[model samples]
Target chain A: MIPLLKRVAVILAAASFAGALVVAMLDLPAPTVHLPAAVEANMAASGVAHPVTAVLLNFRGYDTLLEVGVLLLALLGVLAVTGVRAAPRAVAPAEPAKRMLARLLAPLMMLVAVYLLWAGAIQPGGAFQAGAVLAAAAVLLHLTGILPGWGAPGPRLRVSLAAGFLIFLAVAGALLARGALLAYPPAQAGMLILLIEAGLMVSLGLILAGLFLLLSRDSGDEA
Target chain B: MSASLAFDLLLAAALLWSAWRALATPDIFRAVVLFIVFGLLLTLAWARLAAPDIALAEAAIGAGLTGALLLDAVGALGSRKDGAP
Candidate 1:
């Protein structure tokens, strides 16, 4: 009877907590935010394209570069902490039914990831979302034991991770030489944005996949 | 004030809650998993906030990379013992 009461109490508490979360998020009170109107107006007056991305990789390039460095340091730290161990093979026998399902669905997942990366130009989806999804595909391959060989800090992974920063810097240097740092051709805004975004997607995908496989070299765990 | 701001607030709340729960968990593996979920949640929020650059960084570097690192850390800390809880 006591155990039964405890179980009921626990369930009620969980339900109440979930209810609170829903209320907090779905029925948030109207917010009163005040900001100077001229801030955005001033941005439009200057006429620089993609002030956000500019800030991300150019004006704030130093910060982004530093952040990437930090990520590298963390990866290195993980490798150091966990002496490299080949990921263990799954102990369980694969059910033929599940294996067939996995085989059929895998290609579709990869296609969806590619489509997300390509369609990011004009939608809510973008390089980051696409890259994360792509990394998930790589993880599936790894889990299913169908992955081709992976080496630590492989050439492809190295190139993908470094390319984004290098390309951004190169573009910035060209603009600097032109006497306006990180400037884009006003007429070719769409083309330029598309280019940068594509590069970002590839770099992001590589960085994510590399981090996973590299760390897995020692830990070999994935979700 | 706007629909976007409201959305950002909700995202922020979710991130906070995930982080809190991850920290509160006693089991190490589950905590690590929840933390990874927190990272992914932040990526979605960043996108809605019109920070695609941040969203990219968060999903790839923050969520994916950081999650890998911490999971490896837990694995290094050693799995629970045969007799001990």
Candidate 2:
């Protein structure tokens, strides 16, 4: 038999939570300004027409820079906890259909990722979005056995993993000669933003893909 | 009053139900699958909220990557032969 008291408690808790959410949603006042005046005024100066990218990479560049550091730190932590080596697994034969799909879809996914990165200057796409797409493609490749190994990432992978952070720092440092940290010259802003994003996309993709690879390295070995 | 609103409400309900089931289900595999579905529902909710950027993020990072991770983790846990229904 169902526990009546427990059922009632769950119902009450759910109702209260839902009611509070609805009340909050209904009562929350809309912001008076859509985009802050500062953001609106200097949006064009940010190089990219997209406000979000501008804010992420320029207005609040320090935050993005630190966030990349945080991601790398997390990976470091994971590596520390997992140790230097993963137990080798028996190679499983790849299904032909999956192999064909991976070949067909990998290019398509890469193309989409490039498009997203390029579009970020004008549209909703940006470094994070493009990076995620590229990572997804990499994950697909790993899954379909196209990558050919479950071994620890090589030196090239390691360098590219840190590429985004390094490039961002270099850009910020270069701009110091002109003015404040990360402040690009007006004419060079667009080029700088694009350059930074391209590096960020590659690094973010590699980092995320490496994370998944680490997880799958010792598959079926633990509970 | 509009059909889209009705659809959104239905989607919200489904999201809530899926989330509850994902947490409460006894089967680990089923729970992981439900969690993935819940993530997709969240992607839809983000779209309905007029946040395409967030929707893309939810679809890619939240749903796709996290779901893949969870499923892989579950697979690594190994199956208990006697635990099967």
Candidate 3:
């Protein structure tokens, strides 16, 4: 009787909360400050044809920079908690069908990643999406035994992992020296954004993939 | 209502139902699968709102990566419980 009462109470609370949210949505007033028009007006000066890219990498660059830093920090936290040194374990070969799928898909995914990065300047894709696709490819390969679980990152691996954040920081610093943070010269903004995205794509891919690879190593140990 | 509005309403209902089931389900695997369904529904919602960028990100990172991670965790938990290789 008590359990049923408790469930009824919870459901009633949830229903009321959802109803309130719907009411709030229906009552929303028109915004006085229209951001899209403002963004459109400045698009030419923002150095990217895509409004979303312009805002993300140019106008609100600090947010993106900090986001990258946060991701790197999260990876560091995971490494510290797990202990950086991973014992190497032999992985039994995956079934032939799985192996073939991984082999065929990984390269194609890489191509898609590059395309997404390039398309960000004009379209809906960007470094985050591209990096995720790259990470997904690595995870698929690891699962299929084509790639091994990570141990302690080598010097080269460490550099690759930090390269994107460092490159982004360097650009921000250079722009800061000019006057303000991430204030790219209009003429050079396109090249600079592309360079940062390229670096970010590689680093973000490694860091995201590393999160899985590092954790999976412990599971592999027990198996 | 217009056909698009009707479709949007149906989508929203599915999203809410899936979210509720994902939380209330007894089986962990079924909950995770429902969560993935919720993510896909969210991706569709984003696309319907004409925010293709967010939709793409939701599909890849929110659904794909997160689903894989959750499934992996479930596998690890199951193995530990069974004490089987």
**Model 1 agreement with the true structure over A46-67: per-residue lDDT tens digits:** 2234455444443454565455
DockQ of 1: 0.20
Per-residue lDDT tens digits for candidate 2, residues A169-204, read 999988887689998887889999999999999998
Clashes of each: 0, 0, 0
lDDT string, candidate 2, B1-85, tens digits: 5999899989989998999999999888999999999999999999888777778878999999988889887887754453476
Question: In model 2, which residue pairs have backbone atoms overlapping below 3 Å?
Answer: none
Q: CA lDDT, every prediction?
A: 0.63, 0.85, 0.91
Question: What is the Cα-based lDDT of residue A148 in candidate 3?
Answer: 85
Q: List the residue pairs that clash in candidate 1.
A: none
Q: What ranges in model 3 sit over 4 Å off?
A: A1-10, B82-85
Top of the candidates by TM-score? 3
Give RMSD to native, each candidate: 8.6, 3.3, 2.5
Write the residue-wise lDDT of candidate 3 on A1-223 in tens digits.
4599899999899889989998999999999999999999989888889999999999999999999999999999988987876455635679999999999999999999999999999999989999999999999998888898888989999999999999999999988898999999999999999999999999999999999888777775554
Please give, as one word, the docking class of candidate 3.
medium
Q: What lDDT is reached at residue B6 by model 2? A: 93
Ten-residue region with minimum lDDT total, candidate 3 chain A: A84-93
